[model samples]
Target: MGALSDVRVVDLTQVLAGPYCTMLLADMGADVVKVERPGGDLIRSSPPHLDDPEAEPYGGYFQSVNRGKRSIELDLGADDDRETFLELVETADVVVENYRVGTMESFDLAYETLAERNPELIYASIRGFGDPRTGETDRQGQPSFDIIAQALGGVMEITGAEDGPPMKVGPGIGDLFTATLNCIGILGALHHRERTGEGQYVDTAMYDSMLSMTERAIYLQSYQGSPPTRCGNAHPTLFPYNAFAVADGYVVVSAFGTNHWRALCDGIDRPDLADAYPRPADRLEHREEIHAELTEWMATHTTDDVVDRLEGSVPVAPVQDTDAIFGDPHVHEREMLYEVDQPGAGETVDIAGSAIKMSKTNPKPRGRAPLLDEHREELLAELAAQHEAISEK
Candidate 1:
């Protein structure tokens, strides 16, 4: 059993942000009931399918985020299906969704209605701008995705090269970060409910999350009256703290401190540079010159050679790709990758494991993502039995 083994969640979410939130909850042992529309999640048709052509509906994109959850098909447009969803909600501890601003209200299944049916229901929503209950935005009804969030929230502005156009981060931090924050909000609401026997609506916006992620820029803009701009791989406040090109690929080196700078200079056989620039301010003043010298020195050595020379004294690492990560001993030692049986492909596939480690209540994926309506009959029977028991009382 995991930490949240007793909790049940009605997951009415699709795509990355909402499903990723419930994925974490499910990893922590919440009984996540994924309520999908008849056509199923759009990501199910996304690319990178397994070898088998006859496999089930979903591909890797869907499988990665929707794992270890029970799936039930429900069309809220239909009266009976809507009633069934409400019944499931009545028995659930939490209900989460990532629909448009007023979609739930249109279906007459908003948090207000769900909370009325189950007073202690923790209703959570993930939106692009956020729910009005928190703070209404001018863009409340406007649709958004990860790229939009990144561009509008100051993240793209401060990323990439100083000379290039604003760039979005490689991964969808906009969606993933919002999902993580929403999960935290849900956990906090759950704690409050445990104490007071009352639940509340919780939400996080992708744009808001991106703004929070770029907090340093916000403060700089406020204090210095200047917006932060991209500085390429170098940090705004630190020098000799950027990626350097080696013989084979690149390696990031950070010799920001005085001792580290001296060590780096000694390692690269440039003791004169260390003597000339002792302080960080001095180094920053001559950033271009020092960077050039370092670059020249680094180009002379391979990544492995540089690592061997500076591993203990300087913070340095080769820029690695997924293949390198897969073979890294540290990854295996930390249990960051898991191999799970995929029923559709009839083979085991590797998926990322949980980062949140615990001594006793270790959280993990319970199983693979469920087939469409796979648990519908079992769930209906369980709900019927629950209703009958309540009626008997």
Candidate 2:
């Protein structure tokens, strides 16, 4: 049994955020039933490129997020299917969905509707803004994608360089972060349910979660002087505490403490240079000179040389690109990734492993993501039997 072996999640979510949350639960040994519509989730059709657009149901994006989930196709709008879904809520420990604000209500499947059947259900909703405050209709109208969440929530403003055009990260970082926040809230509510024999709603707007991540910028405006600016690769508090040039790539050095500054001086065999700048202002004033000197010195050294001379002794690291990150020693030891032999992708593709560790329960991947509606019959039978039983009494 894994950490969440007892939890059962009915995933009425599609695309990213809600699905990602259910994926986390499924990864930890929860029973996650992915209820898709008749046409299946739109992600199945999304592409970087597919071997066969019509034939291949497991696209890369869909496959990655939906792992360890059992899929069932149903038309939630159908009267029989709606009753079937209500049956699922009656038995579910949690129901996670990312439908627009009133989408569930429109289908007559809102938390209030589900809660009447199963008051013990942990109902989670992922919206664009929030349900109560942020305009409900605003979220319901047009689809608010991941970039929309980041772009509107001040993430884009502080992402790239101060002068450069605002940029979104390569991955759907906003959705993933918001999904994680949703998981945290759901877990809390679940624990409360276990204790008090009660359940509650967990709602988080992706925009709200994104805004929370920019706390320093937002909070600084109310109290201190200025809103935080994008410094590219620079740290907030110290000089020489950012990425620096090196022989093959780069190294990040944090000369934060006086002792660390002295250690750098001692390590580089430049004691006199250390005394030249003792305080923060001293380093800040001569930052260019210091950076230039450090860069020139680093240009002579390899990444190994950087680590060998001052890895633990000082806060410095050789900048690792993608390959270096995968081959890093710690990644191997911790099993942070796994080489999974995928169905179509022939060779083993490295996938991220579980971050959460449990001493007694080992959470291993049970199965790859299902083909569209792969377990439809199995789950439909489950719903039919459940609805039948509920109607009996």
Candidate 3:
């Protein structure tokens, strides 16, 4: 049994953010029942399928975030299916969804309605601008995706090269960050319910999450009275904290303090430069010159050579691509890369494993993502049993 083995979640979410949040809960042993529309999640048809082209549904995108959960088809628009969903919610500890504003109320499945059925149900929503119940926003009705969140939330403005245009981050931090925050909110509500026998509404906005992630820019703008721009790989305050090109690849190095700067200089056999810029402020002032010197030094050496000389002395790591990450011993040791069998693909594939480690109940992916409505009969039987038990009482 896992930490959340006793908890049951009715997941009325699709795509990245909502699925990811419930996936985390599912990893912790929550009985997550994913309710899909009749047509199913659009991501099921997303590209980059595994080896089998003929596989029924073979998208890594959908499989990665929807793992360890049971799925059932439920057309909420239909009266019978809506009633069935309400019954499921009545027995659930949590109900999570990522629909746009006012979508749930149209079907009469809003948190208020669900809460009436099960007073202790923790209802959570992940949206682009958050629910108005928490706080009103001008953009409450506007639909937003990851890039929109990144751009409006100030991360893109301070992410690229100093001379280049604003850039979107490679990964979808906008969605994933909100998902993580939603998970935290749900956990907090669960704790409160445990103590007081009361449930609450939990919500997180993608834009709000991105703003929180880029808090450095907010503080910088407030303190300096000016917006910060992109500085490429270099930091705004710390010198020698940037990526340097090596013989074959790139490596990031950080010499934040005087001691680390001295150690780095010594490692590179540039004690003269270190002597010239002894203080952190001095180094910051001559950042360009120092970067040039370090760049030249690194250009002549391989990534392995630089790491060998400064691995323990100064913080340094070679920039890794997916192939390098796949073969990394540290990743394997930490169980960060998990291999699971994909029944739809008729083969095994590697998915990212959970990073949140618990001492007593270490969470991991329970199984592969289910095929569409794979657990329909099983869940119906379980629900029937639950109803019978409640009736007997």
Once superposed on the true structure, which residue ranges of model 3 sit more than 4 Å away at CA?
A: none
Candidate order by decreasing TM-score: 3, 1, 2
Candidate 1: tens digits of C-alpha lDDT, residues 1-393:
899999999999999999999999999999999999998877888877787876875777888899999999999999999999999999899999999899999999989999999999999999999999999878998898999999999999999999999999998899999999999999999999999999999989999999999999999999999888999999988988999999999999999999999999998888999999999999999999999999999998999999999999999999999999999999999888877777756787878889999999998877788888889999999999999999999
Where model 2 places Cα greater than 4 Å from the true spot, the runs are 47-56, 133-142, 339-341, 344-348, 362-364, 383-393
Question: Is candidate 1 or 3 superior in lDDT?
Answer: 1
Model 2: which ten-residue window has the lowest total lDDT? 133-142
Cα lDDT of model 2 by residue, 1-393, tens digit:
878889889998989888888888888899999999888888976654345434454566776778888887878889987877776777789999888777888998878888889889998888777675234534444567789988878778777765787777667867988999999999999889889989888888888888898776787677777766666666555787877777788888888678888888787777886899998788888877987888788889887887788877899888777798898989878777765444555544556667777778866555677777778688878877876888999
Model 1 lowest lDDT segment of ten: 338-347
- Candidate 1 vs candidate 2, TM-score winner: 1
* Rank order (by lDDT, best first): 1, 3, 2
Question: Relative to the unseen true structure, what is the C-alpha lDDT of residue 228 in candidate 1, on a scale of 0 to 100?
Answer: 88
Across residues 1-393, which tens digit of lDDT does each residue of candidate 3 receive?
A: 889999999999998999999999999999999999997887988977766755666478988999999999999999989988998998899999999999999998888999999999999999999999999988997988899999999989999999999999999999999999999999999999999999999989999999999999999999999999999999999988999999999999999789889999999999999899999999999988888999999999999999999999899999999999999999999999988787755668899999989999999999888888899899889889998998999
lDDT of each: 0.93, 0.79, 0.92
**Model 3 lDDT at residue 136:** 96
Give the winner by TM-score: 3
